[model samples]
Target chain A: MSTPIFANFHPDFYVERLWDKCIKCKRCIRECTYGVHIWDEKKKTLKEDHTKCVGCHRCSAMCPTNALIIRRHPSDFREHALWTPWFIKNIYKQADQGGVLLTSTGCALPYKNYFDHLVIDACQVTNPPIDPLREPMELRTFIGPKPEAVEVEEVNGRFRLKKKLPPVIRIEVPIMFAGMSYGAISLHVHQGLARAARDLGTLYNTGEGGLHASLYEYGANTIVQCASGRFGLHIDYLNAGVAIEIKIGQGAKPGIGGHLPGEKVTEEISKTRMIPVGSDALSPAPHHDIYSIEDLRGLIFALKEATEYKKLVFVKIAAVHNVAAIASGIVRAGADAVVIDGLKGGTGASPTMFRDNIGIPIELAISAVDKRLREEGIRHRTSIIASGGIRCSADVVKAIALGADAVYIGTAALIACGCTMCQRCHTGKCPWGIATNNPELMKRLPPEVAYEKIYNLVKGWAHEIKEMLGAMGINSIESLKGNRDKLRAVGLTREEMEILEVKHAGE
Target chain B: MPLELEVTPFHYSQVNKIIREHISKGEREFVLRGVNGHRYLFAGVSAEVSAVIYGTPGLDLGAFMRGPVIRVFGSVQDGAGNTMDHGKIIVHGMAGDVIGYAMRGGKIHIFGDVGYRVGIHMKAYMDKVPVIIIGGKAGDFLGEYMAGGIIILLGMNTIYPERPIAGLFLGTGMHGGAIYIRGKVRENQLGLGLKPYALDSDDEKLLESYLKEYCDDFGLDISEILKEDFIKIIPYTHRPYGKLYAY
Candidate 1:
């Protein structure tokens, strides 16, 4: 309602109804939640307001007669190199209403993505590649600390493990769904993620939100988070998850706290997050207790103590500068795993500046952290989970090759669940029902449907990852870890290639 | 009969393992002797059990504990009841910082002084209110970012008469809940945007209900603790930082 005329004049998307192919049905009006479509009785035709559309393409996909065309508005303006449309329009928005420029999902910037420049190597005639169809190619990954040494003893002519191993989260695929709180998305998405994780033998993080009562049944596949807000955290919620993750910061908005606006804090969200109905869930910027690495150690052990040391405990931080050193300290602080989220990490809502410009890319961070830990003789002590901007199966394979134990996908997971990345999540009126809490919009994404989509997505990606592994002549995913020799960079600077730990294409 | 477990010789893990083992075996009452800095004394004991600790216990003494009544005879360390869902923790002596950090339900009654940031981010829901009643003086940054619950600081009969009842930055960044100081509090001692108000009937009732149990926990007279008029400190807005940023 507070949208200024300057923003309204330039539509972000152009929604057109093909008159010749139009069936004159009212399906567009019903499908759109942004009030973009209206049926005129006099002309027996439909009209649309392109400015109201967020480019979700829901109507285009659902159009019965395929009469809808949605694209970026072709409106032209004299281009200024520095002040682009978004910059100029954002200035207008702030001048009129003075609210933080907010957005959802990953950063939309065109920063140098190392994944695009780096290519995975394939086996030539000299090395025979294993066919995934015939040979057993292991993709199984265990996320936790490994013992310093394994002591085996002979038992009735059979070798047996002599000591009890630490707890671990076992996953068949190296890809996982990143943390998206129940309040940020709909309950349907959380249920879907949980069911998918259960069905895929993987894990889905619950973000900082406490576990919903209905989701406790899928505890074996869930990773409950403890953040600064400490919301909805109790013994039951901690025990309900397979692992506990201390959410120090997120990739999208590093160093800042999360604010689930009061409007989106519905009754069920209030119940799940353990706050009063209609109250904003403000997670504090810092865990007040964790002021130093020792303090972090205290909380890490505290969680371990709470769970009686049965569940693995992980620490997640954004891929900021000096991330490698930060990760080293975290490992020394006794975390079983470290989750590094890059600048391209997605969020339900984040200040645009922080989302785009705050953190480094996951590619560099994972390489740096893995190399540092290995140099420090502690790489085997913990696992590194890289995330942010993981697009397809190739990206997943590259991340693992760069020394990540696995990767977490937030935006990619949502895209599979029908998100078009329209950047309207902060408005809390998501037309695709992927980022809204409204009951009607949430109904569009049933739990079963979301589960099916995400399940197929991961399943398909897993097969593709196997194909990549087969081409690389690697029999197991673990054998590919930290194997930067299998990667080559094209058109990257020497310094960038050094940071990425990949060689030039010819070399 | 309470089972006696001397936890001085074994590691915290072994001590805690034996303690939880008895708990799962339906042992409701426990007596931990010589508990010299043994951490996680009753961690994750969800059943309705009770423990009597003799010596000083280490960090997170009862973290994530549910429905357990704990009575510590000696002073306790930081994170005494960290994130405990239900039950009571009664410390006969004093407590360290973050004694009840982020605890959602149950009550913590410390008989003596407490360290800084004692009740940081403590929360409450519906009828399940988390309460922390400190008998002596408190340190700085008390109740910082506390969302919901009640923190009653009774600065009566403190050892350090030279110091104020509470240090600087009291109730800093508090968005919910009320802090009842059993005496006058200067505005300078409170955090920015926090105001002190006179107690209303509901505040009086809430204080009375918790103080009755508090007085019994420490064997103190309820009338003596309530003799002084109390002032309350609360955030004016639930969202203190709501209007901070531009869209």
Candidate 2:
């Protein structure tokens, strides 16, 4: 085989073998698909090729004696905080390939997690905490435009409610699966998410890859996306979902379009995406017809017309600097809801520079949008869904308190299904089979197994959210939404606290 | 054929309700008059019905419609026949932008001009063909990102014969589908990934059949329209950005 013009710059992981414990079992050699471990026939011992290791830890987990250890390669650069080892290595990578370096998953840079700094208030005096075990804590959330006021009438000595409201989707929990296409992940993963969404009474997004025929049975729990590519978009696809989301942008790569390489467009993917086999699926940066807010309104109404106004329509945008203004325009454009994808959002593949350096974090975006809509007296016009890096139930609670109706979890969902976050999803060779399309690798993940794990993960988070709400002296999740008085920010500037509409700690 | 509904004061929802109620009662043929800009008329109605609309219909007139024939006597608004699987929409007057947006299977015959991005992202599946025939000129970005289906532009009354029939960047990012223009097209007006070709016998046959229906709908002479020389624009390669990546 011919060598590449550019060599592998440096080892990303170090494989440490316990010499006394290894029994030459060769399990690591068999488990690693990247060829990181090889059995040396001449010496009758295992050898490590550290250069190929993606730090997925597949071999280490498979080792019977726990003889294999994987660690991040030690920083070898001179101690300079500004020009760190990661910075220098990325420079080398760009210099070698002269191409945009692609990475997967969320941002790995050290940014403050606002959720950790914000503390939820618990009742001590004046009010008492309700035990969730014995009390009924309503976690059900209705996502759509709420009515402005209730209208009642008395007809023939009988009082009746007479308010017509927009269509709303009710979910048992306020947590939902974010948009991730089938070609980006495996069919089994999509099935797992679909099953989990059905069991949890939530919705899972199809993420612009068109709905598969087999998954049509879960239409009540599906949110089909109509992206710029218009892939696999037909009348049936539009009518097969509970809601339709117009994907304007994603947080990881805000201003650019998505390029699914022709190589990844296998036969099944081609059918799902409605493109020719081996043809690249290029979603343009902007919808060709939607140039202004009026254009967006036209498309929104068009979709509503297509589905006969039976399904809620959502407009999803990245959390950019002007997210508040953009969100307001989306509401005015007749969307039933708006989703803001923050900078820490995960992706199947994105340029490393764009993923790490584009868009604002979800915390600030949600707060600003919420404040803007409230100031305009249009907060009840539509629902807001905050998505990015919501790690735990606390993050979801914090988001709701900051004015979000719900939260979408992408990377966390993948991690629940055995993903190690190796950030090699773009390679199409994921070892755990969650992000790859290779038939052999995809076979490793069974839909039933993934379904159970994800179901338990969301179920646990829902219980925790209920516990937090009960401790706050709130019986329903709605009472906690937009109730910023229940939260206090620590280590945040006065301006930051003002923007978040929360008080500083000990105020 | 005896049912008649006046949609003047009723909201779009009420209009649709009345139409659906009539449809559910096995009334396939109806006359809808006094339609004053009501949107979503006959949307997602998958029945073999014929609706004759008199006044101007609003946006998305026959969206997601299947197996129905909607004949509008007046003009229509934007997004007409949006994402329709199988249907026939005949518009007598001018239509707005994004006409036939992402329509997979059906036929749309427009008698007058249309706005920008007409037939954007239209595609076809196995044995399902979608066709759009425009009698007059079209705006910019015509057939943009067109994956499959066929679009024909017949410049019957050319305001400027010196200029090209369609606007700039025609067929931008078009991978599949064929565009037939019945006038002169300059090389500079064409977008990337496209190459102009002469009409083959099969192309002539397809154009003849579709134009025969179009002529029948609009009361035009098919022989006079076919007398003009036509040029066919198709994508040079199915994969436009196949070599844009390193790996």
Candidate 3:
């Protein structure tokens, strides 16, 4: 017999079946999309193959009785500090297949998560904290370019604005749905996101994939993206949303591109992307026409002109080194908003190497960009949206205090929609149905059911944001913007604090 | 009747504002003279309007415009027909880079040579098949990453005879589209796994129809332009990167 791979022989997860509690119902067999469970016909019982388990826990959750426990395999190779098990296993897999390692979602490496090391400040004796229930707090945020100065004129014994400003988008909450492409995820999830955004008075992004014809009614709450591929880009799609975003780079895989495989291009996806059925949809590493900052301005104006200057235009870039300079350039290029996605962003599919090791954290990026733009006196020209790795409402408050105008939450939204982050989304076998396009899996997540869940999550977060604001003795969210005095680093180094533009605790 | 103007004194933005204001006022015809380096002219004008421009126009001449016909007598800068939905832009002189980038529905007929990266990622939907017929040579990366639409490169009647009919990386990463070269292309000039083939009847019909329009616009003989043996290039497989990943 051929030698089995070590990872398969000693799997990452071990499924323990409590034979004492099992009733021979074989529910696990029906729920296992990875085909890990089976019915032993001779024994008339249920069995499992540990090697096939991705640790999604769908069967365990749906099991009638508490009969299963999925745990990490307590096995290890010879200990080596530098050469870890993951590197060894990945090298073995690459040697066997001789192809690029593909992965789903964000970086799983144990890099420093700055959000965990920072703390928010609260009111003390000098200022009393207000009660959120008894008092009204303003969480209303506007996203667009602000003029250099406000000018007023007297008309009919009434003072009115002298000049008209550009279009602005108002959101009741400071949180938004990150750009999730339609082909990478199911349509039900998109419908849920769109409806929830409408319900919450916020916006949801349509990532590069063209908007579906049925979702035209929700254009007022949508921000359609123009990716490098220019997929489904027409005059109608350009004007189909409240604003337009030009996707320059994604955080999970910076400097790389995106490709939706031909096999996954169903008829519906083909029509939305405006490509032929079964054709590979490729977004190259760069827009061939965009080679400089001026070129970036060209495309921004193209979308603005395409939409007849009625909608705000945003530019999304990965948070890499010198991000502050890049943000300033984008602001000067006529961008109304700059979305900086950090390295911890999620994706449906990306090369493993790029996903794990590219771009800086969003915290440092927000501080750097905000400081640079303010120094350049162009901070009012654009709004800064910090994305990637934002977890709870606390993270949103901290991000705003660190200098972001708002935050985009992707994984948090997915978790609310029943995603367990199995890390197997690219395999097209997502049991919870959040990432797959297969009809059988797609039916598992109904849009009507998922929209309510998303709505609850955002509404709950908005309330929590108000509470946090009240604790800080501030009743409005705008007061929290760039107010680093409310934040103090707990365990970060001096250099790190300097980069984040925050003071150390007990200083 | 055309609303005539001398657009030399105003900036490109001001000229565009004037054009937009006129377009919204039901003025469907315009004749602008001395339009030196004026960019974004007639942009996003979806009306069935027409413009006759004299002197050189800057970048993105008719970008995102629909239902408007523009005739330019001088050479244009970069990004002439950028993402244009529906219109006709007839350039009587040479053009710059990225002329037909992402154009969905329109006909761009350039009477002279074009710069690099022309027709990149130009796609089509239903009856909105975009067509670009180049009367002279093309620079590098022509038709690179094209998903759909038709590009015809006629490398003749140009000042740069030393240049190749089309440059390197022609149709690189192309899928779901056809590129027709007037004569022939070496195997090295083609994208990976893409091959040139003899024209079928349907291809000949497409060429005849599109070339007649080109010939009529330039006042050239259709027979002379079609005298050479043309070749068509289409990808061998729509899924070029299917086997590139392990999972």
Candidate 4:
């Protein structure tokens, strides 16, 4: 045999099999597509090849008996806290191929989660907690630009309202399903998210992959994205939505574009994206025509003109260092809403360096943008939607209490659909069928089941949000929006508290 | 019969409202006079109406328009026919920058010169081919990142014939479109991933077909415009960054 092109410096996972319980049933050999388990016919036994395992636990879950276990491989090199195994392995990977390291999912570094640092306040004697079961606790939210001042006119001696307000999307809950493109995930996932959005009276974003023809029925709950690729953009696509989102940058891979490999551009994906079957779909880093804020205004108005001003338009940007200024520019550009994606956001695929080493956390970005817009006296001109790293209902509550009109959950929604966060989304062989385009793998997730699970997850979170609001003695979610006074920080520096516009605990 | 609506005070939103209201009430033809810088006129109006404008209209004229015919007697501001899906915009005078930006379908015919970044990100799908025909010279970065469609720049009434038909960095990042210029193009002016090819029979036929309509509308001689040799610029590959990644 010829020598291998690249060296396998180390195995990331280790497989342990119980000899007494295995019984040589060969279940793992059949279930594993990574070839981690092999059948030794000469010895009439099964052998474990730990080198090929990605620790997805596909075979372990499928095993009839409790005989297989997979764990992170122990480090064998000389131990140094600074030179961790991951760092050394990454160096070896780059040294071998001289290529940029690629990874998927959110940042892996163990950064401090600000959501954990902030605490929510409850009512005491001055205000009484309303029982949600007996009293009506409103969770309904409308997302769009609010009128700074209502205009009135006298018609035939009767005063009539003359304010021409922008379109607003009403959701039963303050939680929304974030933008996840069709090519990055399977059709079943999109269908599930669409159905959930429709049933829950919310919106689901079609992230730059273009809306599938079959999903046109869900247009009432869909928000189509117009990214740099300009893929699959036509009159029908523009008309088939309640709103349009101009994707300036994604939080996970800020300042970088996306490259859907040619191998993943199957016939169905090619039709949706409007490219050739075997050609790579490359979304350039920046829109060639948009060199300034004026160009951005032109694009935003172009979409508005195309849709006849019937749908709201949003501009989604990554939360960079100057996100406050960027948000101000977007609002002044006449966008109906603004979406800020934090550094901890997830992606289908991103470079390893970009995912882990760029962007600020969502908490700081949201507070700063909110304060800046309020200071500029244009806070009511546009709505702000925070995304990235939202895990539970508490995070949502904290986000709204800090200043977000709504929160977008991508990874949380995926987890409800049976995702394990393996971070192998770029590999196209997802064991859980959450991020793969392979038909066989995709079939593992049924839309009906996924939809029910997602609906239940968001419904549960909505109930929790209502409960939190009730505890604060707030009857409506509108009162909780940008109410930073209801929150306090713990174990945070004075500068952090000042930036977040919150007070210290027990002060 | 065509209806008439005069817009004197120049409000962009009011003009569009009137156009939409008229179109909704089965008014298919309209004559809009005193159109001084009213942006987004006839935007996203889907009716097959015929509109005639007198004065200069503002930015984003006929944007996202579908199945309408708008003819401007005077020049227009920037971003005319921006992201238009299906329709026709005929301008009698010069146009501004970023003309036809991200337009997917329809036809825009400009009689005079246009500013920078014309035909940027103009794309085409199956059976829907967007076409832009400019009679005079064009500025820099023409057809930048153009995925699909056809752009023809005819140097008919160009003031400076010694200069190139288009400015520098023409066809930058163009992937799936063909741009035909009436005059010579230097190698230094061409952007990366762009190459000039000799006109084939198909290209000549396309140019003749588009120029015929343009000349007919502008009262120009098609035969005289087509007499000069043309150079075709096309992207080197549909997948420009295919080999940039490692498996």
Candidate 5:
């Protein structure tokens, strides 16, 4: 027999019963982006290379015959009890050492005690919930520029600028779609977001991934991203949006390069991006030119110059331990807004290890950053947008109450558009066809339908947010931001409570 | 008449103003020589023309191009082919960074090494196949989430002692077409999501035709170029990203 290349092999592991159910249809092999399965016609059997599996579950999900039953590799630790303990011990060592976990994409860490760690409070007897039907609740708030400081300037018996700032450029709601590039998802997804944001009177982000020509009509409601890649970036691209966001880092792949592999680089995507086909589109891990706060200002000014300062410039950073320091720097950099993505933010694809590890939680990260900025007295200078695991309205309320001007929705947006949280987005075989770049699959999702869903989701969230605010006796979102006095820590230690800057209820 | 716009002191003003007017007037062919790190050289040129840039051109060269042929005699900087469509782009020297971001169509040839994410989200249309060829080493994610078209990485002679010098995450989420990496690469070193095999005779012939055309363009000896073995990465099926999710 030929030597088995793979280290671990078991003959008994292969179920003979599965062969009887095999219909000879190659759907699993065909659908699997990783090419893990091969049909051996001569043997009347399907050969699966377990090593090649990225655990996307696309194969089992796509199987028409129900022949393929993919389960977690069955553990035999009890049979080989001696080696199992060492094996388990080594994994802890790896975790303690802070070494690379070598995962594929998105967070795969075992869900920690999130509910216990974070807590929200509501005034029970004193604050009566305002009726959302009769009473007017304000979720409306501008995301762009504010006055440099709380000062009124008089120029020759008149204000310096003739145009009065349109009372916080009122949006009907607080929820907005987070930055997911056109390349990472599909044009249909972009159109869906654009249409949805427009309908909802909110905004959708065209991530550092370039904007397709088709979605140009929804520019008024769009937040065009200008990341290190600079794809689809031009005077027109800059000017053709409500806001321009400079993407510094992503929560999923923090401190890593923004890489869109060549295979996903299709003609339409390439045209939108203005890059060549089948060439890796690399966004540098670090903005090499931006060495200091002064350098960041130079970039900000350059963008301002290019766009004639009409568009709002936002500096986006992954919420790290040092986010407070970074946010302060961004404020000094003269940015109108700051967007912070927490560790749980989603990606089309990222190293599994990086996604699970390497960043601070949104709850912890936000409170710390908010406190840091406020302490530095720069909190009001720039607007704050927080992302990562804002799955529902409660999270959004908690986030805004914790000092965020607004919240950016990522995983939730996907969920609204029929994303099944399969976590197989890195492989371009998203069955709902939302995340992959595959032309055939992307066509499955009509832009119109997808857009409507996003619109509905955001609208639903907005209504819920208004309700939450009414219950808290607050009418406006702005009044709720950084109002952590309304919230309290549940199971946190004294130090943790201090760090979160919240007291226990009834304290 | 072939016009020469020589870049001096890293200032692209003299050349840019003229090219802007020339492109506005719909001039087809222009040559820019001695471009030594001049930034934003030919950005947002929406003409169906060709400009051959000699020497290194700095950041965002040929950004948002619409049916324009841009050939770099030497290297170019960040955002080389950012959102370009319907033209040919050739880089003789190594490209600095972020070669083709979300490009739709057109052919880009890199004679030397290329920086990361060569074709991030490169899509294709019916008959409008976008082709990219890299002569030297490529950075990570060679063709990330590519919906269609062809991406060829010819790992030519490298100064680095590493035998198989290719990028990480090669052909990740590649649904359609092929990625040809020259030379045998170790499994771990290649760092691709997909495992590819050696090219068949028919595919080798197709690659040879392109290689021949590349040789003619850059004046390379065809025999010498074909000396190295080529590995062809084909998705097991045309629809690698088969319907895997549902509402």
Candidate 6:
């Protein structure tokens, strides 16, 4: 018999026997959102590339065989007396000092530069741009119920009240707070958000964490969330809101439960959640009551009945592979608005793997959802809110141009309110106490300062947005959304170019 | 006013939803009949409101009830009287699983068998302690992680069958509550995550009032039901598992 043509067809990187606790159950392979783990049948073992692991730990939870454990990869380098290990040590010091672990995109490690590689052009000649300082800048936008049709009539003795049938209301700016539950962040953070929203003429979200009795007075400016756990949910919570948000999934940790470990369920937290003290709060990934689009409609109507149809309903979903299809489904599900979070979103404490590798980019996801809704002739039926990695004013402008009626800010809001993103939120050891439930740590987030910072951030962004709009010769934000004809894709693949539907520059 | 109504499959009646929302604050007396397979009946109603279910009800019947009285004429679906504050829910027929989940105040009376998680996470406020009286056998996790209040399981069936009275994980994380399971509970079948003990005279007396209420609601002989033995379960402390990390 002829020898095998290629005997050394083995994977280059393989798990050593030391980590043999792994029973080759393929649980890791199945649960990994990053597509990192592979099965080597010949060796009857699992092959994992350290480079591919994002450290989400979703695999650890599903390992029924109790064979797999999750941990950070150990790195070994040649012992050098020079400035070696300085970079790594400095990174550690930054974390220890409660400083920002500044990162780009979803993952921290350098991959491919996409956003920075592209540039936006400004018109100097031909287009007579209005100066932001001396011209009328428009940021006014509406989000809720709009009339199906309009009718105008004149009366003999008095003018008619031209019944504008639209149920949708308008917002002065295209900005709002995203979902960040009470258990995920601190009460002070929520208070800060509430105050900032009221001050900035915007809306703040309660996330699925359930409303604390303390924050009930901010009802008009607040948006209560109904999530899987149904934590702290009651009649008062339902009625105390301007809008109700049904969270299907999060951009950072989609298709997974938001686990509030038992360690953080303090007395106050337990009271707020209505669960007994010292028990873990588990927010299921899916709403057990809702199974399909039609079921979602039932819930929407149920909320309407409970709240007497006084509040609008918004559906928040993660940006996933078929987000366009999902968005279309949500529109048909009878939601007044849809909020999509890109994979690059932030979470108080998500498995590192899911946070870094799962889901699609916000720009692509927003553009696709928008195009699908428009193509289906339902674009005007529901408002779209895009989130995830919206860092600066320019990104917000880009998101709006891509087709989002508004944007929800999460990580950026925390940053404005003294969050350094030390990545220790899971430990609840936040030095700034912005994400901790500990009484002492929580006290660090005073409502006064946090509110001021958020107000300043929103004001600065609002100003910049107007400047960008005026420079682009756009009169209003409504005129900018989904107007991709004014945008161009730079260095994108053919498929991406088609998906974004933006032409090549100068094409 | 005592109202008599009948519900068929096509009747499409949601008495629980309508009466609960429309009932003005402080209004009490109510009698409802003909409630067959209706879901979310009397959900989210506050205390002081009293109603009676004449027939079998759908899922989540009388959930989040406070300061009210709800008597089920027939077997109740899953999650009966969940998250109630204060009131009494008497089940003439068997009750579905997860009965009285997260109940704070008031009492529950079940003449027939009950499913799992009975009185789970039950608590008590100042001057208000919740109570649950089960007539037949109970499923697992009876009073699991109970924070406060009292639970009385009166196995009124005399002919002492071989089947276990309560299931596993009884009072698993019980902190500051009392659970009473009466009659003969086999030693080997006591199961894990619980500490069982005999009921005291004080405990029996505490259950006596709830037993009388149960008998009155279903028109059963209170003396016969009280003749049997009773076991009481009390959660160890208020913070059973200590402070959790997640708020």
Best by DockQ: 3
Q: Write model 3 residue lDDT over A359-457, tens digit each, in one string.
A: 998888999999999999999999999998998999999999999998888888888999988887777678888887778878889998779989999
Question: Which pairs of residues collide in model 1?
Answer: A99-B246, A99-B247, A100-B246, A100-B247, A101-B247
What are the candidates' C-alpha RMSDs? 2.4, 3.1, 2.5, 3.4, 9.8, 13.1
TM-score of each: 0.95, 0.91, 0.94, 0.90, 0.64, 0.72
Q: Write the per-residue lDDT of candidate 6 for residues A1-507, one digit (tens) a residue.
A: 944322122221232223646666686776554456788899887776644443445455457766655454345447786645535444444544433232212344343333443345456889977677887778888896465555667899776658855466466778898888887788888988888888787889998777887788888778898876666666678778888898888887889756665567778777766655666666656664466897687567556544555788999899999999999999898899999998888887665557777788888888899899888988888999999888888888878878899999988998897664545565555556677788876776788878888889999999988887887887688878877776776777778778777777777
**DockQ for candidate 5:** 0.06
**Interface RMSD for all numbered candidates:** 2.0, 2.6, 1.9, 2.8, 9.7, 7.7
Please give, for residues B1-247, the per-residue lDDT of candidate 5 as tens digits: 7666666643555567677777667676888878887655555555677788778887656655657787787777766766555577887888855666555567788888887777765656566667788888877777765656677887783444463467666766565557787776566643334677888998888888877877776888878877888887755543343322110
Give a tens-digit lDDT track for model 3, residues B55-81: 999878888788888889988889888
CAPRI grade, predicted model 6: incorrect
Q: Which ten residues in a row have the lowest lDDT in candidate 1 chain B?
A: B238-247
lDDT of 3: 0.87
Candidate number achieving the greatest TM-score relative to the actual structure:
1
Model 3 pairs whose backbones collide: none
Candidate 4 overall lDDT versus native = 0.85
lDDT of 4 by residue, B1-247 (tens): 7888789874777778777887889898999999998878887777788889999998788876778888999998888887777889999998998888777788999998888889987776677789999988999999987778899998677666676778998988676778999878888899886778889998888888888898888898888987889999998987665555433
For candidate 2, write residues A283-319 as lDDT tens digits: 8788865889988997897788667788899999999
Q: Candidate 2 chain B — worst ten consecutive residues by lDDT sum?
A: B156-165
Fnat of each prediction, in sequence: 0.50, 0.41, 0.59, 0.29, 0.04, 0.04
Candidate with best lDDT = 1
Scanning candidate 1 chain A in windows of ten residues, the lowest lDDT window is A271-280
Q: Return the TM-score for candidate 4, rounded to 2 decimals.
A: 0.90
Per-candidate DockQ vs. reference: 0.54, 0.40, 0.56, 0.33, 0.06, 0.08
- What candidate 5 gets wrong by more than 4 Å, as runs, is A1-105, A110-116, A148-170, B1-247
Model 1 per-residue lDDT tens digits across residues A1-507: 754467778887898778898887888999998899998899877898887888889999999999999988999668889889988878877776677787778888999898999999999999988899899999999999998899999999999999988877899999988988888988899999999999999999998877778899999999998888888788888888889999999999999887787667788877766666666788878887788999899889888877888788989999999999999999999999999999899998888899989999999999999999999999989999999999999999999999999999988889889998888776678888888889999999999999999999999999998888999999899999999999999999999989888999999
